[model samples]
Target: MTVRVRFAPSPTGMFHVGGARSALQNWIYAKQQGGVFVLRIEDTDAARNKPEWTEGILSALDWIGISRGSYEGPYFQSANAGEHRAAATRLYESGRAYYCDCTREDVQARTGSQYQGYDGYHRDLGLGPGPGHALRFRTPDEGSTVVVDLIRGEPTFENKLIEDFVIARGDGSPVFLLANVVDDMTMGITHVIRAEEHLPNTPKQQLLWDALGVKPPVWAHVPVVVNEKRQKLSKRRDKVALEAYRDEGYLAGAMRNYLMLLGWAPSGDREIVEWSVIEDEFRLEEVNPSPAFFDEKKLRAFNGEYIRALPVSEFIDACQPWLTGTGTIAPPPWQPEEYDADAFAAVAPLAQTRLAVLSEIVPNVDFLFLASPLIDEAAWTKTMKDGSADLLDAAIAAFEALQSWDAESLKSTLEAVGAERGLKLGKTQAPVRVAVTGRTVGLPLFESLEVLGRERTLTRMRAARLRLV
Candidate 1:
């Protein structure tokens, strides 16, 4: 059989980071097996599904190397309603499933607890298909179901403990479990590699596959991604959207590399590796089944390394979106005409090393472009203290007299001015840095001053001095 793996995601909201991880895994696995990768939009949740959300899924998959048209049908699960319904009917006709009219309150009244699920009350009652009648599978009362997973070892679920789940709702529409299995069967999905949270429903899906006279796909349940507190990453709580990271200046290469390392790592002692290396070395069997922590700090560090690794030309191009407020990125501090490309190119190398993400480029270089520096009140309150006017006076006088207006000369001149006051370069430049950059922390002080030019730098200092008075 041709190995076919599908990434079936619900078009409900943002393309989740965990779902992105699973998609990449599925994409790679299909390639490794010389199989086909299928993109199926489980657009069944009508209440929440939207066209834009489906497009977002396609766009997200494209962003992470699973480009459009490189894979099989972006088949919609809703489009296969006939097949889903046909399978449910077949299951009912074959005695593998039965119709039930028991309501939630009726089941709870009988079972004596709300936590207890369907009691299979109508299993042998032979309630025919009618309004308010639901179809449920007849789970075997004896043996256990063993799910053969590649990453996790075979997990066995006893038949007695496994409840007969609903295949179709009272309205005759198939529910997720049955629809999911039917869709997989229709598309010939050979392997179901997905997040570990789905492991609980695997036995049910596997049972559906068996009842439909089709063999179940091989399973691989990757570890669930968690936050620092070890809680499963939630949409409402965590920054789980993949698009947010992309828009925030995360390089696709860095994201793909870091995401793959959530539960598995490449050979040797390195977390950061190339895409080609990851594609070659990734194995489902080697993936750890333990919960993987989504360390935002570590991913940021990884992105910094990636940003620094880029050639100056590529880095400049990469920063354009965030620089000019393209798409969803907010506009920079400076206007279009105010932004000086030449000045930015000069400080690009310095800024490259300091950035964890590309969005940080705007603030670090904002002083160079703006007509006047955007001062930080806190930095001003901290740095513009006793005798700062005198220091600015002396520094401005010394700088105004300079023949050479460059970084090295600028640094030596400032150092001399600080030495006269019995201060070090750090103490001396703190005031100058705040006067110019509007922040206590930023790109190097002397280098930024060099790029800011002699006249503008002095004007800002004088402005800061006037503010002090």
Candidate 2:
């Protein structure tokens, strides 16, 4: 049979990194096997589901370069309400499911413990009592269900310990368990790759699948991504939103590459591999069983690598959005139309080595585009106070005498003036660096000077000398 996998995400807020990783693995698996990859929006909880949240999932996936129209849909779970209801009704008629009149209070009183979840007191009862009762599947009492896991190996769950989970709420609406099972069956999903937190619910889903007479999909429960403290990534407590990364100017390629390393590393000691290489070598069996920590430092490093790899034009374009505050550009924020592309190109190589993210490009190179260099009072006091004004003055005079204003001429003139002042190139460059770029430690001084042009550079140098005296 042909391989088929589906990424069924709930219409919650911005898709979590955990969910994104799951989707990525599923997509890669499907692509590698020449199988179909499906996108299913599980928006069954109407009360909690917002339209914007649904759009957020789609947008996040699209931003990560996962294309739509390649698979069946963006099939919405709400749209399959008829199928869910039909499947639940069939189970009820076949003695696989029964109506439970047991109220939460009733179950709690009999069990004497709220900690163990719902007691199975009403399990054997066929359509027992009350009109506003929920429909629950009859979990088998004997034998254990073995999950032939792709990563964790064979794990067993006793059928008796599995509660008779509710398939449909009293309002006749299908819950997540039933809706998921029916949809996956209908969609012919051959694999179910999801977070390990869902592993506890797999046996319940497997029981429902058997009750409904559908073939159970293969299961692979990847480990949860954790924070530094090793706690699972939480929406409330953790910085788990994917949009936040995009907004902070992380390249999607970089994020994808970093995510790929979370649970599964590439062959040998190599960390940075191309997407095609990842797709070719990615295997469900290779995924780790332990949780992967979300390391911002490592991710930033990878992002820097990806940024450095981009073509100069692409890097310039990528920096645009952050520069101009306009979001319309492709690789939006990479390079704004208002930015001087030639200036950017001149300094791109210098900036590439120093920057860990595309977002850093603007601040590092902002001196070129800003109307004036942003001089830090501390840097101005520290570097410009000690005999640097004389050097600035001499450099300005030398720069004025230069016939050409290119990087070559600027470098030679600045070096000559610094040598006259008994200052080396490094010491000489600092005052000019602060004067031109408004700070120390940025793109190379001469290259930045060339971009700033003869007039702006000389003007800034003059301004700094005046500030010094």
Candidate 3:
């Protein structure tokens, strides 16, 4: 059979990281098998679903490189109301489902429990309606429903434990359980891969599948991604939104790599691998049952590694959005177009090694583009307090006479000038480094000066000398 999968995220809020991972796994599996990956928006809940939230889901998936192929939707469940209602009506007429007039108070009074679940009430008592009736499925009271799961492996839920769930609301709108099963079946989704928290809802869906007489999709419930506290990732308690991470400057490739490693690992100790390799090696069975903790530190490390591995031109292009705010870089406090590309390229190699996030590139390199380097008070006092002024003055005079502005000439001249004043290159470069770049420790002093050019370098050095006076 041609393997097909669908990622159906409800447009209630930002696409959570858990949902992104689920989408990614489905995408990877489909790609590996040369099958189809469908992007379906389950926006049946009109009360909570917003158009912007639905768009956000698509944007997030695209940002992470999970695109729809062959399958043309984002088929909204709201759009498929006709199909869902039709299916529910068919089941209702076929005796697979029946209308129950049991109110909240009636179910509670009958069961002597506050939990609102329709278990024996639907099966023991046949379909009867008085007022405010909702359609409920008649679950099998005997035998167990065995889920032939790809990950969990032959998990069985007692038929008695499976309640007769509501297929449609009293107002004739389909619930999630019914909508999900119907959509999956209509889309020809062969595999249902999702977070483990949805495992409890699987039996109901399976039961619905059997009742509807549609062949059930194979199930693979990957473990839920949790926080350090081992609780499920929550929007309230955790940074579950993927957009927040993108805003904070996480590379898409790094995020994909880190997420792929959450429940599965590649060959050897290397955690960073290409997407093609991940697609080739990725298997639903490899996913562990235990929840994986979302560690920002590890993700940052992986991001840094990916950033450093990019070719210089690609790195420059990647930094462009952060620098210019044109592409994927969302509008924020930092403006990348106001930045200097020559200065960035000169210092790119240095910044690349030290930066964990692309956003860090702006602050660290900000000193280069400013009108004058903002001298840190402590650094100014420490480096220029005593004998540093003579070195700055002598270097300024020597640099003033230099015909060519280049790294080699600048380095040799600075060293020669410093040696004449009985100082080592390191101590000599300290004040000049601070003067040119506003920091004692940064990119190579001469190369940075060369990039800044002769005029600005001399001007900043002269200003530093005047500060001493």
Candidate 4:
């Protein structure tokens, strides 16, 4: 059988990390089997769905490199309303589904408030289609539903306890079960891989498929991603939005790598392998059955490793978007016209090692582009206290007389100045570093000074000397 998989997401708001994980697993499975992957938008929940949210899902997928070319479609589930209605009508006419004109209050009154689900009061009422009635599938009362999940192994549910679930609402609108099964059948989705939270709904969907007399797909419900508190990540409580991570300067490649490791681990000791390695080695059977923790610290660490692994030029290129700003991210302190590519290229190497995300590049090198650096008051006070004036003055004179204004000469000159002052280079360079870069911690001091030019360097040092007075 050709492995066919689909990532059917409901566009309620921001594209979530949980949704990304599911999509990625499906994509990996398809690639591993050399089969087809499909993107289906389950927009049947019209009240909560938005066009912008749908666009966000597609954009997020593209950002993470999930393509549509090798796949089938981003087919909208709502578009197949006619097929869904026809299926519902077929079940209703075939005695597999029946109209129930009972409300929650009626069921509770008949079966007491302790009753959990629909009591099936109208199951054999022999009622035809009418107002104030929902279409519920007549579940078998004697057998069991064996969900043969690949991840968790086969789990059986007693049909007696499995309530007669509604397939369509009172207004004749097809619910999730009907829409989902109909689309899966019509689209030929061979494997139903999704979050473990949807596992309970599978037995009901399987029953729907059986009622419709169509073979259901293989079900593999992976573990749900939870927060530090062990609760499922909620939009209100957790920063789980995938686009938010993108805005915060995370590389999409790193995000994909980190996300893939949430519930499944590769064979070897390393988790930072390339995408091709993952595609070649990924297996659904090896997925863990337990909950996966969405640990931000580990993800950040992974991102840092990926950032350092980037080539210098590509790192600079990646920092460009965050430097200028995109969407809600405000631009760096420096003006766009003030940005000097060659100067930044000179300092990019120093920033790359210190960076965990692309956004950190701006703060590390913003001093180079700004007309006047944003001086850190604490750094200035700490480095240029009383007794530091002579140090700054001496360094200014040393830098001014330099024949060649390069990193090597600047380093040697500064070291010589520190020696004359009876201080080590590390000790003496503190005041100079604070004076020039506005912070003691930043890109390498001499190299930054070289890129800033002799004139600007001297101007800042002299300005620092005068400020000490």
- Best of the candidates, lDDT: 1
Q: Candidate 2: TM-score?
A: 0.91
Clashes of each: 0, 11, 4, 0
Candidate models: Cα lDDT each: 0.92, 0.84, 0.83, 0.89
The local distance difference test score of model 3 is: 0.83
Residues 1-469 of candidate 2: C-alpha lDDT, one tens digit per residue:
9999999998867789888899899999998888989999988777789999988888899888796666669999888899999998898888888888778888778888776667776667555524688998888879999888898898999988888889988878888888889999989999999999999989899888888888799999998999999999899998889988887878999998888888998898998999888988999999999999998888888888888898877887787777677663234223344467777778877887787876777669878776687777787777876688788878888999988878888888888888888878999889899998878788877777888888988888888888776
For model 3, where is the 10-residue window of minimal lDDT? 329-338
- The sequence of per-residue lDDT tens digits that candidate 3 reaches over residues 239-267 is 98999888777889999998988899988
Residue clash pairs of candidate 1: none
Q: Sort all candidates by TM-score, best to worst.
A: 1, 4, 2, 3
- Output the better candidate (1/4) by lDDT: 1
Q: Estimate each model's TM-score.
A: 0.98, 0.91, 0.87, 0.95
lDDT tens digits, residues 156-211, model 1? 99989988889999999999999899889888889999999999999989888888
Q: Which consecutive 10 residues in model 4 have the weakest lDDT in total?
A: 65-74
Candidate 4, 164-250: lDDT as tens digits? 888888889889888999999998889989999999888889888888898889999999999999999999999999999998889
Candidate maximizing TM-score: 1
As for candidate 4, its clashing pairs are none
